[model samples]
Target: MRALHPLDFLFLSLEKRQQPMHVGGLFLFQIPKDAAKTFIQDLVADIRLSKSIPVPPFNNKLNGLFWDNDPEFDLEHHFRHIALPHPGRIRELLTYISQEHSSLLDRAKPLWTCHLIEGIEGNRFAMYFKIHHSMIDGVAGMRLLEKSFSQDPQHQGITAPWCVANKRTKRLTDPEAPISKFKKFTNTLQSQLKATPTVLAELGCALKDKKNHHPDYVSSFQAPSSILNQRVSASRRFAAQSFELARLRSIAQHFNVTINDVVLAICSGALREYLLSQNALPKKPMIAMVPTSVRQDDSDVSNRITMILANLGTHLADPLARLSTIRRSVINAKQRFQRMSSDQILSYSACVYSPAGFNIVSGLMPKRQAFNLVISNLPGPKESLYWNGARLDAIYPASIVLDGQALNITMTSYAGKLEVGLTACRNAVPKMQNLLGHLEDEIVCFEQLMTTCNQDSINTMQHTQPS
Candidate 1:
């Protein structure tokens, strides 16, 4: 039994009835052509028989100072099979998942499950994989999905996620409480003392950048109030939309920015439209809390991330202008982030993210907001992936919604497309699906902007030419 890292422990600390701290995904898979009606049944049977073992983080429970395990862990209690009701459409499937995502996970067992869903349309099946955020972050979660699956469609006899994972020799079985609390506290205090200088230097660099009026890094509590900054409810409403990776890449190439920058700009435009329709659009550009992964060698199964507050540029009306502003802001933040190691950055984030704890407990919209919302871009497999003869169509992430931030926008790139998943508090953000339409409109808005900009450049060149 190992001790939970301070960052990983905070997720569990923040967990409550209204806000369940879990990161999940909705996977759509196409069954094999030769598959019989019992395909789903066969899959479920295999999982039920598979032996579940305690993996890192998953095995952890509330120990005295650390997380330990239960002597009696049940596998069946964690895995289940369910089918959609009449009219098994994607929309209906999402509704079921929305309800599934709202409830709290049973802490008595492992904090994860795989619901093998049948009766989906298009001769396909769906799987709703929900795991507590304490166990993994988005990047690690993607790796777990890839590890549990196979590259070959015909690859068979794969065990359930709970049963098997990437083989690691000599699991950490250090009898629980091998280390004393006093020693652990001493080690933590020493590390903080060493990290303080790097943290201060990084802060100095950011301050220097901001003094130049170059918008070095966005500070927390600078967000303008909006509906999205309210305390979230238990009910969640998820909506999704996708665009070809080729198109987004093309736009990125044209604008000379990274794919991630383009994605953030698109979200910024959608949020602008969303809030404007509600007559609550903020006067200043809102803040988007973007998570940056800090994984080194992937030895741990828990979170290794430091978040950056990015300006979403909701204040900019022009799509191209918004993209440019976001590009500069992200670039500046990335420069500062590059100078710090993973541990030093984590220390900095802990200091910065601590302020949001107030809202998490009391659900009171702070006089000053930490950030408006969360936007994450998680990369997926470029090649086609399959699981036991079923073609993996897409993987859309359904991530965590915090107390003050009611909305979360996470996207994953699969094959040649970027599937954007939007999760929000059902009551706080009504008709959340409208954001899908707004996203589509934003993509089109950028395309038109790009074309018009190119034409104007050409006309100016022609007019100024020496004939």
Candidate 2:
């Protein structure tokens, strides 16, 4: 009976025949000798017993639609067991699972799906999980995984946090009962009534908010006559690579910036070089739609989704100057976010960001325009985690790329490594492999700069020291 929040519903509605909006992860684990089968069975059992709770921003009923209400919430409906055919390499397994995860899940069932993959080339196993964009953002999804995993390698006897115990509370089955019906109806009415005034107030505040200005960071919508921006097929192409988290951290420390800032800077430098190579670099600075989570409080569950358009100072040749520009832009954006409530921020994002792109790509409008790309950095488990004594090897995240914005870059840090997953329209970015190289080159560029700065400092110290 509960309704979806306007923003949540918009994300769900953006999914059309061609494009499916979902965020997913591919997890690699080393299977222990005796516990592989046991781990799989226990994982299935845990998913079956787990119950999904309603979170804010969506009505309880609407939030429950994908989990509690859907008959396909059962384990067999969402979780599947698969074995790779002969000559199973990591590339083959990842490619197969990526395509599977890209397909739309049944709307009539839970809005999530998981594939437990076994019998790969070695002792390694893989798990691929896809959840509807409406259900959880990347940060919340990471939290769920952290909660499910054990910190200790020898940990046993404790079920995943998502698992239901034998004495768990059971949901009522009789929907037609007077008390049940009344409570549902009353809750729906109350939610709607509460949202009405809040929506109006947000609109009023948005009018007064000058930070909502849309900077023209890219060229005017010229209907890019490219294969990438056109209608997409249901099929998808996913690529991933990993780098040492310590290396990135070292770069960040050397530059006096956060790890995320370094990441964005690297993307900026790479994209700049890539575009220059194509001779298609835009004159103005390109803007990135950076999605920032607002789940600051523990009690809150997936409450916030806001975006800031970041100006990637690709025009700046100096790495330090580019980092300084990015730092300033991010600081200004964070200050703006601080001034707004969580509801107001999400509402503003939907109104300013989501609609134009959705409408244009959905073919509702002839010339819909928005930011050029999406760059998301989602935090993952800091410590190494295990599944039934098998050490997790790698965790990679794949995100959605819409028609206009033909590229999506999502990064997650897990097990002291920064895993970067790049999903792009295959035709749009034909030489996507170059990006991996570009990322490496940018990192090296930053390191070189750091080394120069350090040697200069050493020379200055030696000159000042008594001879």
Candidate 3:
């Protein structure tokens, strides 16, 4: 048995009915053209009959402070084959996911589930797989997903996540002569101690800048108590939409920003419009806790991410201006992380977020908030992927919405498209589906900006040239 990291244990300790601390993906796939009617049934049966024993995370269950394989693990309970009701439209599919996402995972079993769903409107099916945050984070989760699927369209049979070998076992140079537990603990402590001074110095600068209210310096305490920071119920609402990667890239090029910066701006514009429509737009801008991965390799699956607070600049009416502010804030935060080692980055993040964490777990300061919501952008397979010969269509990520943080927006890039998923507290965020339309409108606005800028540049160049 291996001991749980402090971060992992925190996730397990903080979970409740109001906040089901799990992250999931909704993968839509197209059935092969020549497939028989029993395709779905046969696929499920094949997965059930696989001789491979579940490994690591899928087979790991909580045992006090350590993770141990369940001796009597029930594969049937963790894997379910379900069918959508008649007419099985996308709405019904999303509704089912939202309902299931709201429920808490059973602690007695491994904290994960894979649901094979069929009977959709088109000749497509979806796989909804969710695992507790304690087991894996978004980046680690994506790595597992890539290994389970295939790049070749003709790849045969299905390989569930657990079937993938425990890659961490090979990370150690000599598994047979593993270092002693005392040595490992001491080494970790020494590195953390070395990081303490640097991390604390940065924290000092942050506090000083917060007092000045510097626009570029994002202070967590600056977030306003908007509807998004309200207490949440057990119910959840999920929506997803896809956008072409090329268009977003074009906009990022014209604006001199990263793709993630563009994503933040798009979300900022959509949220602005959504709040305006509901007459709940906060006077001050909203702050987003953007999660960044610090994992150097695929060996570690547990959480190795740090949260960076970003000023969304929702107060600005122009999309370009908003994008500029978003870019500056994000770049500034990233520059800080770049200066620090991974361990230092994690320590600094812990220092910066400890109060908020305490508030979340204890509910001592329910009104105070560090950030309004979470906006995470996770990378996905660039090439088309497949499973059991079925063409993988899109991958939408459904993340967690905490009690105080009522919404989460997560996006993944796959096959030249950006698949976005929005998870929200159903009661706190009304008409959340409308945000999808708002996001498209924002994209069009940026496209027009790109066209006008390009035209002006062309006219200037032509005039400057001698005839």
- Clashing residue pairs in candidate 2, if any? none
Q: By lDDT, who's the top model here?
A: 3
* TM-score per candidate: 0.92, 0.79, 0.94
User: In candidate 3, what are the lDDT values of residues 1-467, reduced to their tens digit?
Assistant: 55677688889888988989999999999999999999899899888988987877788899987787789998998999999999999999999999999999999999999999999878999999999999888988888888888988888876676777754733322236555567766887898999999998888877877787766888767788888988899999999999999999998777666899889999999999999998998888889999999888765457888998888988889777677677777777887788898899999988888889889988888888999999999999999999989989999999999878999999999999999999999999999999999999999999987767566553442233111
- Model 1 superposed RMSD (Cα): 4.3
Q: What are the runs in model 2 whose C-alpha is more than 4 Å off?
A: 33-68, 157-231, 299-303, 354-358, 361-368, 453-467
**RMSD to true structure for each model, in Å:** 4.3, 6.8, 4.3
Candidate 2 per-residue lDDT, tens place, 1-467, comes to: 33354545666777875578888888888877777457766765755565653222111224342224542235566668888877878788867865775688676655677788876777788888887787667776776677667788887654533342121112222244344545666775665555555556654554554344423222223223322344555667787889988888998776566888789889989888887788776665666778898766542233357776666777778766566666666766675557666755665555555556566545665334455678898888889998757788889888887766777889999989999888876666767757878999998888887767665643442233111
Model 3, C-alpha of 356: deviation from truth (Å):
0.7
Error of 3 at 347 (Å): 0.5
At residue 7, candidate 2 shows an lDDT of 49
Model 1, stretches more than 4 Å misplaced? 52-54, 167-170, 173-185, 207-216, 363-365, 454-467
lDDT of 1 by residue, 353-387 (tens): 68776656666655568789999998888888887
Number of the top TM-score candidate: 3
Clashes of 3: 0
Local accuracy by lDDT, each model: 0.80, 0.66, 0.86
TM-score: model 1 vs. ground truth: 0.92
Instruction: Give model 2's TM-score versus the native structure.
Output: 0.79
Count of residue pairs whose backbone atoms collide, per candidate: 0, 0, 0
